[model samples]
Target: MKSSYFTTLIQLLLLGAKNPIKLSTSDLAISIDKTQQTASMHLLFLEKNNMIARYKIDGDDVIQISASGLKYLLSVNQKIQSAFDDNSSTLVTGKVFSGLGEGAYYISLSGYKKQFISKLGYEPYPGTLNLKLSSNLHKQFIENLSNVDGIIIEGFTDKKRTYGNVICYPSIIDSNIQGSVILIERTHHDSSVVELISPTFLRKKLKLKDGDEVKVNISV
Candidate 1:
């Protein structure tokens, strides 16, 4: 997810600039709505990964997206759109899932016979992107049924700030359940969630319950 995000970030940067495509860390950070440090982190990783180019001409430092990054952008863009109307508006609301930092969030929903994550999504803030999963990707969730790591859900909130990384396990769910898990960007926190992003949508789409679980294996 992070890698794909970087691809989109770089692509937008390249396309938005004056066509020369020369940008500084500060410049890219502003465009992506990410902290300069976060932008730098991804940029440096892309550099080491042979996904970008770093060149210093005079006293100015510039970064350019490479073929690999462009290629990656192509793939990322594909997963960022929908076959019809994107329904990524659906989300799970609960406790934070697993991960470090108080910035990122993830939601995974399960069904007795379906998945709801779509290919279309949008970036509303610097560190966050809303995901709408498609039913086709539902199979991918099942392949991850018995693994570590939960999924993410989205909600509507004007205030988005967390003190630590959060793994929001649904304290409440339905009985005829499927699965559920939350991922936040904090180390830890305490709070009761009345409404997860799109509980209504997920309940109907993924067919989840209160006692189910969402887990995934990184490999295989």
Candidate 2:
């Protein structure tokens, strides 16, 4: 989507949000600093795309954004936030935990492993090391990270099933081991649990066990 479209949609949502009643095109134009004709054109496009609804109330054309419009606006806000998050790093603490044995099956898949090798510059171990965030501050970092774009490992289809996309951020574990915070698109784990994969066996090398505290520094 063009940045201009998002700008207009955001302005519209803001104006509509102030009141439950729909907004007049002239009022929207004034709020967004655009001419009425230009605002009407933008609103028409939004309505056509199902982002907003237009109706005649009291013989006047009024508009309000739809639920989809709000979602798109939120996505735009995230993109703006991500633009400012570049090159910044976040340190988060977590406790080691055993996974449900699904990570190995997906990580071992030829399609996924090949890309992980090519993109990450290493062939990851056939399984992931799972960690549960120990603090709410660290958990907020996860939410912020999800709003931004990370290095993506594209998914591919096999004869059996189609694999989903994966997102990765360069990370330093326990201030020593270099790896990534690997986010699988399709996962049985909850948001509080993070998965990592490295060339080395993290459990043995780091002397980690269930309930052991570890710190991961993720590159934003």
Candidate 3:
């Protein structure tokens, strides 16, 4: 059945229209925010599709969501939950590394700093935490993330040069510290190297140093 019909069925279920409970078309109309005629039509459609069983118990109309209807709802719920699980969190394992000292300079720029604060909900510290992927699998994951659209920090120009836009993925460091994995349009690093930015100094906060392993949990 169409999704609209499923929605109407869900509304009916919510109104206690299950297990052969008494339900009126007028009551269903108010519950579904539709006219009585529309509600009656939905009921007919559902009954025709074998999604609902309608009958009269002692001359009063009664309705019940059938086994097939319950099965359909369960299937829809499972699909939604699976999608949520897939997108909710992605773990990327890497080892900490020192950058070329360019991250501090570019992050300190007012043009990028302001947008980082406004869009990312935090003013990043004047530096970024660099990570080298632990394996080819992790590197491939980061490479895939680079292609997807993320929270964009628009590029700007000054008297010196024009800066390229930065794409940011909201992330959690080691499951506690909040940060972002940023992909820059212009960078000295390759896809295997992930650059992270946060409100505080990640190295100091996490007591991390060069070659220290860390996991970044990115929300896609």
Candidate 4:
């Protein structure tokens, strides 16, 4: 929508509003798909005339559209419709890519492998899950891993930016440590797909191998 109309929509939504949505100039620009300078400029004019008042909270500035502004904006509809139509695709414009290598563990969010295994409308973010391994051993690592349950292994990213389906870690032994146990959860689809999550990275720093013969302890 044109600037006048889009600004009007903002006026309508916020008109006479006691406490309106807290938004930044950038946010206004993105919501309406207009230039940041334009949104800020219009908002500035509204504020100067007391048609809208600005408030500050939590280190953020908030604006409440005035009743007078609402009356002026009611004539605009296309801008309002466009604003409501935006979805996630419009919010986060950047994505990442990651891979795993020898004797290293980390969490990553790059690549699109997760999409192949999840249901539609299922957001893969915000799930806190991970893999952990620690060991100083350099040999016999393969023999030690036989006891871990449901372990899997797979190459995270290839030279061509591709990945293999995840498989049981025990099923694929690159090499084993003689002095430590290598714990693995790489079998889970995303468990070992790069250090895509914090828990998995922590596991790597812990230095635990799959399964090494060692003492056991559990304390809350």
Candidate 5:
């Protein structure tokens, strides 16, 4: 996607009263300082790719970013942020948290486990270690990690149901263990809460407990 597209998306998100904003090509063009034709073309592409929802209300264009679109924009934002933090390695600090007991089951699924081994270099232990970000900076870094384009665990479907895609970032847990921070495509946790997967149980190896502060060092 072009920078203009992101600019327009940010414009809409900031200026619109609701999730979607209603506007014409000329209106969008004026907002982004682009030609009307260019604005229309970008809007069309966004609509076709399921990024923005577009329709005609008596000949006017109504546009809003879909769920996928929001996710993509988030990834783009993270990339831009990473560019500014281009110094040494990034260290994210957080506190340990208990999850809903779903991580193990999902990680154990054959569809995901197979790829975890091949792409992540280890078959993750059945469970994931959950951490809650302790600071605004750490939370921002976590979001950037998701956008870094590390090993991708693609979503899959079997006889039961469809699973969402997951993005991983190679990370050093507690300054020793090698693992990856796993961001599930569909997660019940908020952005501040991060999940990590490793070949061994992190809780036991690191002697972690709820509220314990932990740091993950990630190389961008």
Candidate 6:
């Protein structure tokens, strides 16, 4: 059926017609901004297509959306959500910064390396590329990303100390290089710092220095 017919079904739902409710053609026409005849025609079309069930109560017209109609609306809602998710992306600008020189030790550990390969689909380099947020707005974006779900790298224990969990968000740097922004459960850096991991040495690959500005497009 056409979208206009589905629109009428939505109008009925908004008028509390999901269950059997007394609804007049004049009322439906006003809600849909159509004439009474057009409203009646739409109702007939919906009933014939099994989108709505029509009956009577005490000689009064009663209409309700059927299971099939609800299913259609749910499917449309999912499609709309998917469309927004596909287009949703955040651009963050930051400057390259030096870390505590401990990224290589953590990244090279077998416990985290295996998960990085399996979950992230790529083996990360020995060291991480750290970035400092250029502004408070950019720092806020990272704070928001922490609340959402991302590629999770579970922590594990070996013969010695225990490692902490890490959250990674897939990102594109400079519009070409693919990487991830990682949030370590235990870290010395504050909220303004973002650590990234990639398959290659980001410093050499991107020709980056300690003060170079970069843009990362993160997919939430």
Best model per TM-score: 3
Clash count per candidate: 41, 0, 0, 32, 0, 0
- Per-residue error (Å), model 1, residue 155: 42
Relative to the true structure, how large is the alpha-carbon lDDT of every model?
Answer: 0.42, 0.83, 0.90, 0.40, 0.83, 0.91
Q: After superposition, how far is residue 158 of candidate 1 from its true place, in Å?
A: 54
Candidates, ranked, TM-score: 3, 6, 2, 5, 1, 4
| Best candidate according to lDDT | 6
What lDDT tens digits, residue by residue, belong to model 4 across residues 137-201? 31233233344442233446646654443222211111221111123333332222212222123
Predicted structure 2: clash tally: 0
For model 3, which pairs clash?
A: none
For model 4, the stretches where C-alpha displacement exceeds 4 angstroms are: 1-18, 71-220
Q: Of 2 and 4, which scores higher on lDDT?
A: 2
Q: Enumerate residue pairs that collide in model 2.
A: none
Query: 1 or 4, which is superior by lDDT?
Result: 1
Among all windows of 10 consecutive residues in model 3, the one with the lowest summed lDDT is 12-21
- Which candidate, 1 or 6, has the higher lDDT? 6
Q: Flag regions of model 6 displaced more than 4 Å.
A: 1-22, 25-83
lDDT of 3 by residue, 42-132 (tens): 9999999888999998998999999988888789889999989986778898899888899999999999999999999999999999999
Off by over 4 Å in 3: 1-69, 72-76
Ordered from best to worst lDDT, the candidate numbers read 6, 3, 5, 2, 1, 4
RMSD for each model, in Å, please? 18.3, 13.1, 8.2, 20.2, 15.4, 7.2
Which of the predicted structures, 4 or 5, would earn the higher TM-score when compared with the native? 5
| Candidate 2 vs. true structure, TM-score | 0.60
Error of 4 at 165 (Å): 64
Query: Which is the better candidate, 4 or 6, if ranked by lDDT?
Result: 6
Q: Give candidate 3's total backbone clashes.
A: 0
Instruction: Give the range of the ten consecutive residues with the poorest summed lDDT in model 5.
Output: 12-21
